[model samples]
Target: MTPLVELSGAGFAYEDGPPVLRGVDLALREGRALALLGRNGSGKTTLMRLLSGGLRPASGVLSLDGVPVSYDRAGLTRLRTSVQLVVQDPDDQLFAASVEQDVSFGPMNLGLPREEVRARVEAALAALDITHLRDRPTHLLSFGQRKRAAIAGAVAMRPRVLILDEPTAGLDPDGQERLLDTLGVLSGTTVVMATHDVDLAVRWADDAAVLTPAGLRLGPAADLLCDPELLTAAGLRQAWSPAVTAFLRAHGLLAPGAPGPRTPQALTELLGGRPHP
Candidate 1:
């Protein structure tokens, strides 16, 4: 299948600065959850911007469904409506007085009819499981609630692809789990999340893209995330989930052909209550 969005030979650099990303090529598959992994300075954010039409590549092309992306207003509007980026900081995105207003902003700007905007807002709020907080002030929400609210604003646009940067940052374990559950509700949307947490990437993403100064590597999460050399090259450590799952398989506790467990609870269930050898 053709990629929903693709970057070919893309390169970026700040004004007169050294290149942050060079000759980068990436393709986002439809409806697949992707984890963008790299160290702090690996141009992950830059790549996300390029995908979202926030930045024009200094070289090469960014294509949407095989068509080259245009930076003109009409083209950008199409891109923004089809692909939404929710930055790491919710405070930067949410400015409306109330949750409902914030979520409604994007659709309203799209020149949508009042009823359509209302329906979109309702569905987005419900998807994020924050319908009850609709009337609340955006400034008064907790960190997790604010994150969900910000994401709801993007969801209201009904984008085909949703990109999140450091989505689980600053959240407690419970908050992270809740956010992941909420993300699960975005069933038809392709989700791409940039994160520093290798374990989260290993367990949550269907595909993994690791960036390094040397290059970018994209493949099945189970394959790339388990490779110690690739992890080290990307300045990431091997995730413990795969290690434990590998041990279980080696001990004959797990079927050799079975997919690795994504979490501690999943590992336990897969073991079928058998004691560790």
Candidate 2:
């Protein structure tokens, strides 16, 4: 399948400081959730910024849908239309006084007709389950509601790719679950969420891309996340799911031979007929 976005041999640095990302090659596919995993200073956010065209590569190439992305004003405008980024900090994205105003900003700026923009805003707010907040003051919203509003702002643009940085950072358990469920149902949009939460990454992403100082290593989420060595090399601790470990040991399927549980239901089914460990 043609990727929604691609980066080849791309590199970035800050004014001659040591390179944060180099020789990185990656492709974001359609309709799949990709988890960007790494420790601090491993360049995950740098890569995300590059993906969003917020930063251009110092070397190499980036393309969307097989066409190379140009950073010119017109091209960048088109890029932002197709690929929207939701910053981790809600305050960074939401500046309007009212929730409706904030969510309508993207589509409205895209030169959409007033009715179309209104419809998009209404749909976006519904998608994020923040419809009741339409007329509420942005400043009065809690952190979680603000995050949803920020996301709705991006969704109103109807982008093909949605990039979120640390989306679950301050969300409560219910908020996190609702957000994850919402991400799951966003038809035709490829979701790329950068998270340090290994467990969330493992359970949510279909494919995993790990970032180290050396570059990127991509694979099935199950394989990349369960490998302690790979996680350790990327300066992350192995996030072992108890259900996965118990099921694996019970079946004597460890490491190389095991495709452990990706969800709680799968874990339950695996141990359904077996005796307790």
TM-score top scorer: 1
Candidate 1 lowest-lDDT run of ten = 268-277
In model 2, which runs have C-alpha deviations exceeding 4 angstroms? 250-277
State, as a TM-score between 0 and 1, how close model 1 is to the true structure: 0.94
Distance from true position, residue 238, model 2, in Å? 1.4
Q: Tens-digit lDDT track for model 1 on 1-277? A: 9899999999999998999999999999888999999999999999999999999999989999999999999999989989999999999999999999999999999999999999999999998899999999999999999999999999999999999999999999999988888888788889999998999988789999999879899999989999999998899988988888789888988787787777777777776865355
Clash count of each predicted structure: 0, 0
The candidate that wins on lDDT is: 1
- For model 2, residues 77-140, the per-residue Cα lDDT tens digits are 8788888899999999999999999999888888889999989998899999999999999999
- TM-scores for candidates 1 onward, in order: 0.94, 0.91
